[model samples]
Target: MTSFRQSDRLRNVRYDVRGPILTEAMRLEAEGHDVLRLNLGNMHPFGLEARPEIVDAVAAGLAPAQAYSDSRGIPEAREAVAEHYRRCGIDDVSADDVFLGNGVSELITLTLQALVNPGDEILVPAPDYPTWTGAVNLTGGVPVHYLADEANGWNPSIEDIESKVTPRTRALVMINPNNPTGAVYSEETVRGIADIARRHDLILLSDEIYEELVFGDARHHHAARTAGDDVLCLTFGGLSKAYRVCGYRAGWVVATGPLHRAADLLEGVTLLSNMRVCPNVSGQYAIPVALGAGAPGSPLPADIVDPDGSLERRLALTADALNAIPGVTCVPPRGALYCFPRIDREMFGVADDEAFVLDLLHTEHILVTHGTGFNWPEPDHFRIVCLPDEHVLTRAVASIGDYLARRRR
Candidate 1:
């Protein structure tokens, strides 16, 4: 018998968000242990649900969805996505520019596969949503990590990004309301990145999955708007996070800023889309209602979209609780469903963050991912999902505080 192995393309890929830690969590679950999973931004399990209108839309479309639609997506959903962007101030878009996918995850893979050649280099944030790095690797592209300035509210360092560009660099990827860090990019930062892409002739890939999840004054600047008419930009968004429909697998990528310049690339993407047949048909039904109900002039019902502002409240409470602990500090998340806290490694005698996470899981039955899993260069950080209610979140943070207390040197 031959020993089978994964393709060499997977050699450099890593998606530790659901890697060994999740495996350990499942193992513990099999043993009848209750494991609190704080690793992924999965919301439904925590009671965040899709709007009834969106649900009804999908349910009603089930019969029609039995047949495959166009390769790009169902017409109504694509137009809805394009209109959603037009309302957000990206004016020149239309349904023809939209390509719907199973989810942003699949779109990421498709986009990378279409754009990357063997040695192409893609600039990705140091602590990005790991899928970006993993997808780039899977497409045989080199993911160059550009450090986001932690002291400066976790914004991408413009200087660092500019310095990393080379002849081989093909694109720049930015994740606003960044996962694992929860830092929303400022308007100036977004424009600055756009400027870099414009000058370097590199494609701009903006992941704005958490666009509507911003807290307080932290606004999400659309890269397509900032990239304007010269630089080509691809904006990725979905119903997974803000819509609380993770399992629906509905997402889209909109091509903006000089489509003519990206004709070849878009052609490749379309080719791949054709190969996949089409995105989930019933899931695509949710997009039109989801966007229409949440339009600028019209707002989604409170109960459907974070009624009572509990999401913000939970995030604030979790950050405060984590900061209250000795030798631990959390940069308050301005947006998104996570808090990436930095621990004093020397004070805790900790070197490997993955080991620390595993220990915490075994000792406390809590599961959180290591920072390195998101491609953070250091091991002093870890991400926790803030989807749990205030009471559950407080208890979870306290349990983490207690675990840290015992590990302190």
Candidate 2:
């Protein structure tokens, strides 16, 4: 028998969010251990259910979904996506500019496969969601990590980004209400990144998946809107995080900025979209309903999680609990469903974060992703999903605190 090897394209590919630690967690659960998985933004597993409207919409469309639709998506869902972007302040967008896929995950992959040839350079933020890194590598592109200013509310350092830019750089990827960090980009930050893309003639790929999940006064300024009609920009959004509809796998990407410049990339996207036939039909049904219900003027709250307590309340409670632990300092995330907390490395005698995460799983039955998992160039940080309720977060953080205290002793 021959030993099989992975494709050469996979040499740099990684999806650490569900990497080795999660595999071990599953093994433990199979052996009857109760594992509290704080690894990813999977709200359903943590008491939050999908919105009732989304459920109904998908069920209603199941019959019609039996047949193939357009490669892009159904007309109504695409129209809804166009309008959603128009409302977000992006101009000149129409249904024709929208492309739907199984998820932002798939759409991003399609875009990368189209945009990057071997050795093409793309700038990705450090501590990225990992999807960007994985896709870039799979597409044979080189992903250059630009460090975000951790002390400056996790904002991407414009100087760092510009310094890293080279003639070979093809694009810049930005994740607002960032995964892991949950730091909402300020308007200045958004415009600054847009300015970089515009000046450098680089395509901007903005992942705004958590656009509606902003907490308190922190706002999510759509990056494409800030880039205007000058730079070639692509904005992505979906019903996963905010709607708690991860399983639906419904996501859309809109090409914005100068239409002429994006013609080639758009053509590439069309080819890939055609290859896939179309995105999931039942999932497309939820797009119109989800976007329509999220209209700006609506007075009703849209959160499907924590009906008893508001999203703001839950977010605040979770951040407070995590910060209360000794040697654990977390920036109160202004948005998104996670909080990446920094631990005192010396105090815990921790060097390898992945090993530390495994130890925590065995000792406390709690599972979390190491910072390195998200490409955070360090071993002292870890991300926790705040989807779990306040009580659960409190308990989880306490367990971490206890574990650290014992290590210090």
Please give the RMSD to the true structure for each candidate, in Å. 1.6, 1.9
lDDT of 1 by residue, 26-132 (tens): 99999999999998888889988777878999999999999999999999999999988997889979999999999999999999999999989999999998999
**For this target, which candidate reaches the highest lDDT against the unseen true structure?**
1
* Residue lDDT tens for model 2, 5-30: 98988888888778888899999999
Candidate 2 at residue 289, lDDT? Answer: 79
TM for candidate 1 is 0.98
Q: What TM-score, to 2 decimals, does candidate 2 have?
A: 0.96
